[model samples]
Target chain A: MAMDRTEEDDNLPRRLLDGCQRDFPLTPRPFGALAARLGTTEARVLDAFRDMRKDGLVGRIGAVYRTNTVGSSCLAAIGVPLDRLDEVAALVCSFPEVNHNYEREHAFNLWFVVTAPDQARRDAVLDAIEAQSGLRVLRLPMLEDFHLDLGFKLSWS
Target chain B: MTPDPIDLRIVEATQAGLPLVARPYHAIAERLGLAPDDVMARMARMQDLGAIRRIGAVPNHYRLGWRANGMTVWDVDDARVDALGERIGRLPFVSHCYLRPRRPPSWTYNLFAMVHGRDRAEATRQADLIRAELADACRAGEVLFSTMILKKTGLRIASAAAE
Candidate 1:
């Protein structure tokens, strides 16, 4: 069984996450800064990070990968009926290159991101989605990414 | 390595949607019947394996006053792409940068980046900074602004086979 939770446990990840990137101090005992705030020793904090990784809590401790900076990509959606939502979505999502897929409550039932090696392939993917799903694949190519940041505040409490 | 049940469970919970609150993980813990620390620990582990990416926000740029946003594609020479990409990505205006799988023949640009600004001219200036760095190496480029936002959300972790 996992260890029992205490109130103190809830305030650690947020601190580390906050300090990890923006205000990371460049000095010895780097973990000390985090450890001091997290109420655990530097080693425990380090070990905690190791344990978290072992436990599958975090995906990475690096820079967030921005999805739009590659070849060519577009956001596409299709309005599948409630009955065929799953079926049509699967067809749209069949391509391995489709990075993100979602089931939205909006009129266009299934939506996903089609990122290709280039514009032609990008359009081809949309065409393929339309062909396979039998639904109008509304292609909304991004004009600009005004504010895209994947940084979420994961409070430890 | 393959993911464990706990891994799948964490992904399932996280994938469904983010709990709108000051403390989402704790709320997620309440919903999933697992200790909050357990959730955090599992997330740390997934981060290590690269099975999942970083956890962060999906802000609406347009709503935030950055009315102009464009996905800028660059046709940089293979040799200089690395350096130019680094410079482009460092600018606060540029949100994303990556080396995509080379889709040649029709599309020649391998280096891609995005710059968002409060308005069209501002966005163009942000792109200009990148353009200056590339100089003539930037053979061609284009900016396509979003006409409509069809759908946007946190990623869903479910595979079709899940159902």
Candidate 2:
């Protein structure tokens, strides 16, 4: 559902998206703390979350783990013939380890991120993907992360 | 920081999402039979150790009006990539910047940055700025706009592997 942003209701959703992108309260009553900070009631804050979630605006309210800190991860790409793109993509997406998979315009047309508890396991998944897809997997492990924050401010226009 | 059994349990419970409640930690604590303070403290420690990046809402950028998402890749001088990447990554429009190994013959772009905008034009504008910034250091680059999101999900550590 698209957000019906009126003058009054718009600010809360905008504020909630911008303010709570990171550093959300780690307290027992987090919504209560967020409510106090945002100058709203606990119930109202909870309601906003529910509404936003139902609208598909909010992905989740949870912990974002640091890369390579919790587990090993790599950006992988595979070149599939245009005709077989859908088939290849489905095979790649079958693994739970593959969190993100995208079809981009390139010789290496299919790109995805594979994450596992350790390097060995991550490689194993990649090998399996290559074998199953009948395509060579180009494993590109992150050598360095320059800009890591994935959050962006929302413009309520 | 290696996650203890309790920490793993916490991650498993909340990886999907935190319960939407007044006292989410307390609810999690109840499920695990631990004190609310214990759960909170552990989470705090994890954040401090860089195990947990943050505890917050993750808004879908596409849903939030930034529809054009481009995976801008660059083939830059490997020797100078670290310094150049730092500069490129600092740009407000670039959300994620990373250095990944280049595949020979078929692929040569090693630096990857994701730029987002409300539309294709805005996203391309950002990519142009990045190209200009890189200047002579960049030999070639391509902005592959995502046609579709095939799969998207939060990273879930296998419970069996957690032990």
Candidate 3:
């Protein structure tokens, strides 16, 4: 049964969000491959993707680099009050470098990811955030990377 | 191609992981009573078919003292998203980059890139450099350091060795 996507006010873009993730195929014929898997035409797939850009369902699909191999990295967060959460979250998200930022149900309401070349530069990035956002920065670097990569499967159960 | 039961079986076996042993393929073949090379060849084909991405190491950043991870989102003009995204993907620091749709009133990012480092400080710092380089491309940005390490699972491709 086709689930009602109208819960979000009958939005077609929202309905296609999951489908959009499906739209990107790992195969070389990526677009066409994904389209065939989804039982749609490549042109339609392209159009929907183009439409998605105008609408803003995601920022970009790019590589998530490995920290240790490359050079350096860091994780930083701030305790933004609930009221100004969006403002700060937007500020944090506005930076092209800040990828996965979220408001967990906690005092440290605003969280974000930061990357840089070395420790000195990494610290500078944090400093810039503190200066621009004016939120006290709680520096929490990773002791280790236990597990990563949560692959998304578009094949709906 | 049309997927048969054997393909399905392969999928089931590989979902968890390929064994952490030298002869993982042989172990798998033993269960199926097929030659190890046969299993390896099938795996190679299935991987080549895009049913599985790449078989590689997923290091624990924390263990290595490089635990910082960040996802950099970009809001670029629709006209230049793909080109700009391709450029971003090329950077050595960039591991995963892609184009995605942003749902309004809920999410407002159209491009996403991830960066990993030895620790939180290292990750956040790299994010800063990226932001400066992208100063013209994006209007705003922020970094969120992970407070807790979340669930990390292995292959979900259901190839024969994982199960």
Candidate 4:
């Protein structure tokens, strides 16, 4: 009985995240509708999501744009010296256009994305980063994107 | 295609996220000084135009226990890459697959597939599976696991200031 209860508790967040990935009802009482579908109260549904967000399990309930549609973006990397890694990273993060920066395990360690209103603006941001850092930016622009599943299926272990 | 001013405003408003309220869109509409009907209609149109991919929850995979994120880069033959990339993109474990430009000598990888797993071992196994699928078409490949997230913010537009 305890095992059953635990499983039931675990299922709510997983179900909510998996089920609401796309086609989220664009209704006035969206949470209420979601609660009805999940066979729970509206408050409980909201609480579950709130907890997930606070815990960092979910980033946001928002729209994922098709790249180059709303704006232009490209993946860029820099091989910063180990001693000056943090300083350069802070500099890279200073740009509003630079989003999704990561320290990946590679020779070209600092990887980031730059998005701007148009190609010219995007290129300008890249150029600015290069001029400031004095590091050659490895620009890997997407030539083709093979669309994947709209909703990421969570593998519940 | 560039979104008109209104559509751009809507994207800017909700790009961060929808408010976690009973009437999320209605809340957004009020905040943006637009009617609920207008907000819904515009969002639907954006979806139709492929500007908005989908309206949903964006999960932080690392926090969700898929801790190991491996970016597998492949140097595949340019002629056959698109066909192979589509197949690879459809794989259950591969989250994002794209054909990117390659710079010779230092960088020869033109294909990138993001693979997520519970740990390094699992992610490596998944990469191995992709290698087998590619066979000789893939000249070489490497998996670059992220050591840290220096910064991560949702897409932001310069003109659209968040309230």
Q: Give the candidate number with the greatest DockQ.
A: 4
Which regions of candidate 3 deviate over 4 angstroms? A1-157, B1-5, B32-35, B157-163
Q: Write the per-residue lDDT of candidate 1 for residues B1-163, one digit (tens) a residue.
A: 5457766666656653344333456776787798877876666666566554455323345554566756666788877777777777666767677665444453455666767777779778877787888897778766555444434433333333232
Ranking by TM-score: 4, 2, 1, 3
DockQ of each: 0.07, 0.70, 0.02, 0.75
Candidate 4's residue-wise lDDT over A12-130, tens digit each?
88888989988777777878888788777677778888999999999998788888888899999999999989999999999999878999999999999999878899999999999
Fraction of native Cα contacts reproduced by each candidate: 0.04, 0.84, 0.00, 0.86
Best prediction by TM-score: 4
* Chain B TM-score, one value per candidate, order as shown: 0.80, 0.91, 0.77, 0.95
User: What is the full ranking by lDDT, best candidate first?
Assistant: 4, 2, 1, 3
RMSD value for candidate 1: 11.6
Q: Write the per-residue lDDT of candidate 2 for residues A14-112, one digit (tens) a residue.
A: 788889989899877888888788776677789899999999899899898878877789999988999999999999999889999998877888999
User: For this target, which candidate reaches the highest lDDT against the unseen true structure?
Assistant: 4
List, residue by residue over A47-87, the lDDT tens digit for candidate 3.
55455444433332322223432324555668888788777
- In every candidate, how many clashes are there? 31, 0, 84, 0
Rank order (by DockQ, best first): 4, 2, 1, 3
Q: Write the per-residue lDDT of candidate 3 for residues B33-135, one digit (tens) a residue.
A: 7776776666556555554444432333344344566766666666766666766666555656656565443445566676777666767777777666666
What is each model's TM-score for chain A? 0.68, 0.90, 0.55, 0.89
User: Relative to the unseen true structure, what is the C-alpha lDDT of residue B153 in candidate 3, on a scale of 0 to 100?
Assistant: 33
Candidate 3 CAPRI category: incorrect
What are the models' TM-scores? Answer: 0.54, 0.93, 0.47, 0.94
